[model samples]
Target: MRETPVLVRPGDADALAAGRHGDPFAVLGPHPVADGAVVRCFQPQAASVELLDGDQAVAMTRVHPDGLFAVRLAAEPARYRLRVTGRDGAVVESEDPYRFPPLLGSLDVHLLVEGTHHRLYQVLGAHPRAFDGVTGVGFAVWAPNAERVSVVGDFNGWDGRRHPMRLRHEAGVWELFIPGLDHGTIYKYEILARGGVMLPLKADPCGVWAERPPKTASLVWGQPPRPWDDGEWMRGRQRRADRHAPVSIYEVHLGSWRRRPDEGNRPLSYLELADELGDYVSEMGFTHVELLPVHEHPFGGSWGYQPVGLFAPTSRYGNPDEFRAFVERLHQRGIGVIIDWVAAHFPSDPHGLHWFDGTHLYEHQDPRLGVHRDWNTLIYNFGRTEVLNYLVANALYWLEEFHVDGLRVDAVASMLYLDYSREPGDWLPNRFGGNENLEAIDFLRQMNQLVYQEHPGAMTVAEESTAWPMVSRPVHLGGLGFGYKWNMGWMHDTLDYFSKDPIHRRYHHNQLTFAQLYAYHENFVLPLSHDEVVHGKGSLLGRMPGDEWQRFANLRAYYGFMWTQPGKKLLFMGGEFGQSSEWNVDASLDWHLTQYPVHQGVQRLVADLNRIYRTEPALHQFDTDQRGFAWIDCNDRDNSVLTWIRRAIDPHDFVVVAGNFTPIAREGYRVGVPEPGFYREILNTDSEWYGGSNVHNNGGVEAEDVAWHGHAWSILLRLPPLAVSVFKRDG
Candidate 1:
């Protein structure tokens, strides 16, 4: 054997063996010295090591007691493999991990440093990639304050010493390329903090797949993305996403929508939901399905509001590919998919982003700026460039990677204000002493601009309860730049008015008429969402007035009124069948309620309403246009009755709606019509088929050329109790 020259410095060798080397690449890879080249590696479990060059094996000397081995090479340094003999006498051969070049390119470093990398997910995560004609996984993470970081996983026996990473100071990113590791290798990062303390092992922030809850490790997922087959859907998507389109959404929490009772009440897998959920949404005739947040979260109790892995699909479902199949299946059934995005804040789990890298890197140091008191979570530091880049890239990731049609941004009001849910002195103000979160506003505007620019068909909706102005307006016009805004006032007022008894409804008549005062201020979505049915609030049917028959009638009439209103519609799950219990994330919806005729009738009426809403142009063509809706009579509070007309772009295409809120059938009620012709009764909420008294016009009535209620023609008909009816000019 030839003499083995000292390759590494005594201090460097000790650092490597001790697993505290800041730059392991310098000591543990092929290094060129003055005399020759040397290959050194740290294998804690190896008793001895040999370098394999071509057909020769060169024995390496153990430089340090903890299995640090090194040997000088005769020829110029080239690619080589390590044949490590373990203490148990088993020999294994693999390419040296540190000898490979940096996984991130110079351009990637520049972009990441500048925080403008829109596709950051692809670069800064555990990626199974091919490099230098060898297949392996490339690991990268941003941990600027860490003294040292190592990739610990099954291949390395969860030993940080086996694979300490090389830090690129320019981007604050640590990178390593292991030659033999492939997909499905579970891994985590062991970070040595600045104070020489070992922080908890952290999961990959950009991991695309993760371990199931309670076992918080990220998986190396290199599976090719599902090949898109919905070209037709993608092409016409922009056209269909207009304000004039029938935009009814069915909001559902996938886990609790329908669970397998026999299978320990577990939620259905993504692949199973691909068929069942898609089919149900299509059959119900909803234009889109808006799922509650599905990003990986630790607790099922939070209902996915508190997410940790922003890039990963939760393993409670199937893999990311299966989630893609679910989206595809929905598209195949002519339904669009929308997911809730929680970008305002994140949880404080040790493995999450809280106190990441031994610093408040992702959040603010001041609790006033960083803490969300309502959620007990840490708010993202919106002013920080890297944080903004991370959040914006995450939004694009969901829309582009998953083929999602829209994102309903949750708690936008919280993001918009610095003093949200905080006492006056407990909050901090902006640079201009304003309560507005200027940085968050900038981030939101940029995200919306990029989403609309990059994905033309995609949309963003804001769940902002505050009276924020122009929320749905374009960014160029100094607005927040959302496609739609949830009409909180309408939902609140409608629910409040309907919950009151009919005898007292006369005084609350303004609640029904006030929504129209500013209906066109923004592109509004009338959201009867899960917020109404959760958190101790009873179900939609449970809050109604009167006995069984009257309650059902009030529900049907309220539904009819909502559909005829000049806005897009959104209904939470189980509301169609009048479910009488509050929502519970741990249990499936009360599916058994549909067995009774009363509940079945409610379900049928909702289906019919959806069908009519989708088919009738007058009801949807001018949903956001002020000229579409006109009040015929709003001062009829004495009779608890109201009449209105909805029109399409062509005023000739219109429908008349008469609603009687009181429980009395007015047999000789007269209503105004637009034209002198036969008025066809298209829909009547009082029909016996919908569990109503069936007190409606026999078929229809001819409009006489009689001036009534400021109209050219009038029709006299029987208006059913607590019912709403629609009339179309057929002749």
Candidate 2:
């Protein structure tokens, strides 16, 4: 033990050494004494400490044995450096971390507190910054309720007392600039609860980089100066992203999409995935690739849906820069990238936002408003400006930082309603006694408006399953302001209709027609998403009714019908090749299943469907307009046959689609045509190339001038068994 100096109080020295001081800034940095100015430092590993001013040394007295050193200066110096001698006499020099001014500006803090700051990520989190020629990491976090917050990491032996941050009282934000620290420094904030109870070390909520979990340390990083090459793509994306354009999305779960067995079945890295996935999607003619949640989460089973770090991209694939390269590569291939974004709820991880600062700072105090009963997660307190700013800034961070093309906002239905997935009397009503989450509604509209305003051509899509009005309409029009909504009703009804046996299919024929009643209500995406093929629901192929041959034919016909229908398209990874098993997060998708011809045929048919959907203006040019679709015959339920004409803006440019859901072929079936001209059989699902029994359509059919089904001309058609046929009228 070292002798306690008469000048140093026992209580102050003990608190500094013990690392529980609420205000380390008051004692450790330059302070005015009656004599002039005095500087104090607690260097626990130093045997002796010397203060240097322009080559002159003012030896510091060892006030306490635990390495507390103090020096009374005759005059305050402009700057000072500490020369520290280790226990083994190894001498080193460094600028003191405690002497720097606050790194954050007052305006930033004021905006942050008001919750109007859309760019909180620019200020909060650990950033490697150079200030006044001293390189170090600048740290900031909002923990207004904490008694003390310290920057703790490998540098200080994880000691909190060594670097307690300066609190900005008005904003409840704590900030510190530690000199000499650089990028790659792993760190966490040590926060003391208001009542003085020390809580668990918490990860930075706005951190840009993080250790791949089960490790929760936030890594200090600086934004690299990488040049973006997607300028043309960005400028022209609006034309391609609108409702009138072709938007065929190939949904992917990167981890399970493909794995290398030689590398212990590990998923591909970001670069590898960029090359492989980009080529595959481009070859299949998909306009965009939508990845499942890529935010950082601890559990691999959640597939990133229950995220803890909203700003950090999961290190499972790559770092932030690497993810940026992946997006650039996809853009080069004319493929847009959309990530699933979860703002509805978050998991109750100990190191996460749950009970942050020993209070419900990010969530609501009431369980009815804060907790999600079904997921066991915590709902965000959207009413709080800071909480709303955090989520909104997170959205902008991904879009601006990563050049992400879109965000598929997940579980939007849950966010829109207060009583989602809750029992009666288990949820809180809004101020108006309604079930609507008013604060959440405001947050969503604001987020969507900001995303579109800041990043042109970038879209915000909603995974909304309910009949929420105007989901895809503009905010100025009293809407949620999403670019598109997933057409869950169409998917459910279509799948249900296809699952029935042919003999009983006539009884359920209305299931196929019911979706048309509300199909045009919103700009929808007809999705065969991963949700339909997971958790014992089985693969799309497995749900089809029949023998192997019928199952393949049924799936091909369904794809053909979905493509020709009036909506944008989305299909999950395995559905294209017909993976037999349900989706398993840990296991690789059955890529081996494509070896069979039936699976190969399904993929080939999908490719053809995309080709047709892209080139045929009638199929994609007016996907959201009622004029694009006109039923020629929908009441033929006795034979389970349906026919419709899909038209473009110029009604003359149209394609007629007919589907036969039974195993029996219809020979010489009369179908009406709008024009007295030759109807070319552009595509037939029963074609020999697609693993079907060779059926005859001959090349085309000439329409006779006989009025039928409200049309002036009609054609005799041979509809193949369990197949879909498409025809175009030649000029």
Candidate 3:
């Protein structure tokens, strides 16, 4: 049948031809006319066009030489499809994207503007949905400053002239639904900024999967409801994340942990890591594995720190589903997964959130408030409502969708202080004339509150170095609301003392004992993290102050000291087996070191320390409370020896820990005990199993009535050389 057509406005016709129309919905698609509706279609490559409403096909008249086709329909609207014959003689038919209504609901708009939409990712990304009984992908973006936005990819010749999105002005968002488009389709937003200026094609901010770096395009992906296999881990995660629980985290950088040397030295896929990493960590007796950021990033050298796609797992390992399976596999093996989350700042990658929508949409406009000088990155404007919603929703996405047990927030100190890494005059103070970042504090509090409220068992740790008051305290008590804080002071002080020669160690005794002055100020994790071993800082083993055997002994004693410390513990990858060299991101760890007995001994010592830390209530139960720790003899500077007692909630359950720092064996060393009983010798770092001198007490020691170091009982025994010993009272 032949169809009649009406003329379009001259300005609208010109703007549509150039793909710079501000309000394309008003001119294109189905519009109301005098007595009927006019359907205008733009197909620059079409030889001819036909409108199909089921059984009837009406020929559309070409109204313009630039390929504008239109037809007049009945007064009442009817669903229709456009059949186009390309100049190349190929023909195809599909639903017109402009005919579909706006996909975002009013509630979404209200919540998004209010910054309370914790689930913003669900509404604003490319989603494959059934619209009007037709399968297509719904694309939405928050680019209020753009004159026109279109979905461009191979499907439309990557042209901005096709599939212009309809702008929902209330929330400053644009959305469209194109039929027959689904997962695995590569696409990006072609935006025409105001004043007819074209910007670079921007990737989707809410993409769940993306093409690998150097191929910077957002891939259309959807997440269906997954039948998770970690129900048992999910059900009891709360109890496992208690303040007193034994949380020995094994920190790892996935790319360099252990690459397959034969496969062009590429990193293991997520499926391989799921089983291999899970087995290694489980056998090592660690309670959890804290992965470096798994977020999709352009540069692997950043080790996932400078991420571009917050929601998408890095395709360098595997797809998102395989990453999910990795978490499930770890959970199945009784080990929890904690991902390093970076919300403080982001890299200034052009295709990323930088200058999105031709404005400072995600980051601050001012350099003092936005730029990270140290990292050459951009800081998020935490004061912005939508930015807060986006980041908070991302935190929940990892916990909810991927089933991760916790999030160890990266560079929290940088977020807390406005003057961090800045000169005196280069920073802006808060309204109260302080350097604290008030907006970032608010965002952190809200994120933590929502995380704990939503996922009871999941923890949020902060890598905060400063003495921020109550960082791990509850939000209601005026705290920053973190589950744990890294004990950076202890790590630095102890490493400094260990690096010193034992002959000069007496002068640095305060370094080892000064941590207890503020130990209970926060829930602490004694982290020997990746930061310690990278960038020319040699391995932990190389930092010791003695010959090879004495270095091994010092390391053993140090692990024993750390495990029995008054906090949870963390060790970076390769630290367990004593990798000889500093960490290199371009290559696998020195895995061959484990074949030697000295390195194997260190690994065995770490495993036993984990076992004792978990099995003994006194070691972990009072980890955050002062009531659980007491100084037995902290003033023994002359001998370079220190002794302490750890108590559980029950006074009867206690263990005494003693360390001899020097190479001299201190036989008949009298150590104070809380009770009169036979103390069972549990662990001696000098045992032959750990490649140490076999200088240890036989069986156990019985306490005497002799008062010593303000204790009611005392025990005299052989103290090993450059080693630590743990003794539990057995009555």
Candidate 4:
């Protein structure tokens, strides 16, 4: 022993050796005492410890048998390093992590305590930082209920006792700045829970990057590089995302969209997908590509709906920077990106937020309010302000950090109703004794309002199935404040009518015309989404009930109708090529099916539909305005035909849609026209190019001043069998 231990207390040394000390910095760092500077270091496995002053060794006296070392030195030069020698004669040298100053500021602590820190990612994650000229990783986490939290990783051989973090009680956060630890460090928090029970090691909740799942560790990475080149695109997005503009979305499950068979059918990386997908979508003329949830999930079967890392893009593709490049590429090609965001529920994975800090910190305490029976997951406790801040910050993380164009909030109906998927007495109601989840509603409204306030051009769409009134209206007007809502009713009715046999089509004619009854009630997106193809609900092409040719004709007709209808449009991946089999998440889309003429025809029709929908103002300029649409004939149930006029805001410019459900072409069909002019058949689903029977109206038909269907003029036309024909008045 070189010097007498002066300021070290026996209890503090024992607590440090036992790894139960909440504030290691107060005991193990250089502290100024009455006489001089006393430096204490805890090295449980070390046989000896020495203070190193540029290769000069000053021996430290062992104050406790468990290896707590202290050295009393002159206060002139307080800064020192440690040279620790293990019992096996193995030696290592490192800077003292405890000597550095706090990385988080007063403002950060204030915002964190107030639960208003939208950029919690900046303050509470594993970030490579340099403090006091010493570079290392700065780690912080919110674990108010935890008795002790330690940063465990490969740097310390995954030992909790080696680095017990310092607790900032005011903000309920634990932080540690480990010198010499930088990027690529795989880490987890080993927490001694509130009840003295050692819980499972948990991954970082705000991790920006994570190990590819099955590994379950958070990787330390710096901020993503700033080389985005989509300034013009981002600036113009507000104009393109307007309600009056056409939004034809191609919803895709990225992992299953395409795969390289030679590489064991592995999904392409984000970098590879950027070029291939960008070219394909731009060529197809789709305005946006809605990616099925890309957040980090443990199980692939959940398709990212059950997420653990809310701020991390799934490492299944690439790192955060690569995802940024993907978004930049899509922006450069003028295609918007919308990611499915699942804030409704999360799986009960031990490594996830379940039992986080060994308490119900992120979710509810009661089973009635905590559990999601349908998914076997846990519902979030929206009543908690910190939890709400966590989720809202995550929403902005995708929007501002990754530059996503919008968010389609998944399973909104589940979040809206407290009794969702629950029977009587199986749920808890709000103070109002209503089924509505008031806290969740408040969270949703706050999230939407924050998104619009923070980002200018980005938007939000709700996948709400129930008849929740005013879902797409503003929050100030007593509504949910979403930019768009998925019209589940229209999707259901249209799919049901199309699935019926042609012989019984007349009985369900109302299904085809019923959508207009409440089309403008909310800004809607007609979604033929990934949900329709999974769980024994066959692919969109398989849903049509008929022989091969009739099936192709039916699908083409339905897409044409959906595109020309009064709302935005969304179609699932394989529907364009008429995939014969149901969607298998493990495999790629049946791209080979495009070789068949029938499938090729469907793909061709969808391309033309996107092109026409984007180019023609009459088809989209007033999608939410009632005056844009008028039924020419809704009473043709005997023939199972539907005809309507779609007018532009200019009034004179208009396009007419005529749909025939039966396979019998009607020749010399008299249809009413708004004006006496030359009407051109602009798009025909029955054209031979689209693999139909080539029933033709030639090119143009002249409207005569013969009153029919109470119109100013009428045109004698040929209605194709099981097809939809769109007409435009020529100038």
**Residue-wise C-alpha lDDT for candidate 4, range 316-421, written one tens digit per residue:** 9999899999999999999999999999999999989999999998989999999999999999999998899999999998998889999999999999999999
Please state every model's RMSD to the true fold in angstroms. 1.5, 1.8, 1.7, 1.5
lDDT of each: 0.91, 0.90, 0.91, 0.90
Overall local distance difference test of candidate 2: 0.90
The residue-level lDDT of candidate 3 at 673 comes to: 84
Question: Worst lDDT window (10 residues) for model 1?
Answer: 1-10
Off by over 4 Å in 3: 1-5
For candidate 1, the per-residue lDDT at 686 reads 91
Candidate 4 local lDDT, residue 549? 91
Minimum summed lDDT over a 10-residue window in model 4 is located at 1-10
lDDT of 1 at 256: 94
Question: Residue 530 in model 2: shift from native, Å?
Answer: 1.0
In model 4, pairs of residues that clash are none
lDDT of 1 by residue, 94-190 (tens): 9999788888999999999898899999899998888888999999999999999999999999999999999999889999998888879999999
**Candidate 2, residues 527-556: lDDT per residue as tens digits?**
999999988999999999999999999998
Model 2 lowest lDDT segment of ten: 1-10
